[model samples]
Target: MSSASTVAKKKQTPQNTLSLHYLGDRVLRQPTKRISKINQSVRDLAQEMVQTMYAEQGIGLAAPQVGVNKQMLVIDCDPNNTATPPLVLINPEIQTYSPELATGEEGCLSIPGVYLDVVRPEAVQVKFRDESGRPQKMKASGLLARVIQHELDHLHGVLFVDRVRNDLVLTEALNKQGFSAKAVQPIKS
Candidate 1:
């Protein structure tokens, strides 16, 4: 399997690529199954996911967002920087989160045109398998941590909108995007 660094960082035309499931899609609501095996097939999917994410100009993407039921995600916070490589995480698990909290506006490739503020831990320690099936661990902070948490939510059948605290903002954003407010299954804290 090719390394995640081999995937191009530049955006391509999204036509005929993996279709991104939207906010109301049932696929996005379903929990993803952990990838029991990390082979060429999983690597290929991760490569394609990275491509799709770049095409959609998204910082991160999950398997479920593309109608796959696997616990996998691709993230590249700095797509324009060729020096940095994108990350492919299989069966990612957050081991710990910092007590500090940060609120930031979040958006999803699935829920286009709707960005809302959601609070999340300021830092996180995560463990997962890389494309090579080797276990890996990392501590992340700032935007990287937020992206990790956001994409991880997709694996658990959750959306950033669900974590949104303001109903009026979420409803208005969804409505303006031609999406039904009923689609949001709010996660109570």
Candidate 2:
């Protein structure tokens, strides 16, 4: 098998489909605990998360979304291509961010069909441990930066909708998706 095929097989999640915990789920509001050690179980969990993300056609996913209260997240900016690879971050923390801010349409697998514009730093320097427990740091920009920030918010019990500036549009979008606009904990820019 080719390397890409090997990767696909390796990244596959659990046997049963991973169910996404929706926006109103209390699990989504609880802050995730930092992972102290990475092991086979953690690796397995991350694999399951990657599979769930791909199955849901999402670019990023957090441990909270899958009912796991751990600081873990998976991201693949180019999810359309298997060759692009994916990142599994455990206990990720942003060290610094660029002064430049950019607004982009953001969505969550947990929130399902709701999409809203959120403004965030265009670039970031982050530190985290890989799936194998190896410490790593990265400078991320563009879609990668957005995805990292978005998923990081999940680790802190913050949803993208909370960061949306326009309350009118946000309420309309969430209500249309059958989510209560009251659930949003807006953060002023």
Candidate 3:
């Protein structure tokens, strides 16, 4: 088989389906935890998360949003998004964050087209583990940092909708144009 075919087979599987998709009602509302022994099952779940995130045109997705409620999450911000490494984070944690902040349009698969202007740190340093149970650390900025922060929030029972920084009514208008449910609250003197 060709190298492409071989690689495809490695990433192709049924567990690659979304565990909880589209504003998953009450199930997604529950909190997630950090547990021991994620194993292959967790790996499968992460795979499914990548597929689901791409399918939904999302930059990131979380385990709790899918009903797993773990510290696991995924990031595919390779710009081109080849999905290599696939960014399968287990028992993930953010070790450091930058002081600078920025506001950009944000949305989620669960909340659909609803989006809003949300402010986040301009950069961050995150620490997490790989599917193989190996520890890893990442420092990111720009769009990549934004995506990481978004997924990390999912693990902490936070949503982009809750992080909006602009007027809610204006956000509703933006959502009609395919935005998230909330906007970042602006800083005032």
* lDDT (Cα) of model 3: 0.66
TM-scores for every predicted model: 0.94, 0.92, 0.77
lDDT of 2 by residue, 1-189 (tens): 001211223244434358899988999999999998888888888888888888888889999999999999888878766566788888999999999999899999988899888889999998988876778888999999999999999999999999988889998998998999888888876
Q: Which structure among the candidates has the greatest lDDT? A: 1
Ranking of candidates on TM-score, top first: 1, 2, 3
Model 2 ranges with Cα > 4 A deviation: 1-16
Model 1 regions more than 4 Å off: 1-16
Displacement of residue 108 (Cα, Å) in model 1 is 0.3
Model 2: ten consecutive residues of lowest lDDT: 1-10
Worst 10 residues of 3 by lDDT: 1-10
**Tens digits of lDDT, candidate 1, 107-170:** 9999999999999999999999888888888899999999999999999999999999999988
TM-score of 1: 0.94
Against the true structure, candidate 2 reaches a TM-score of 0.92
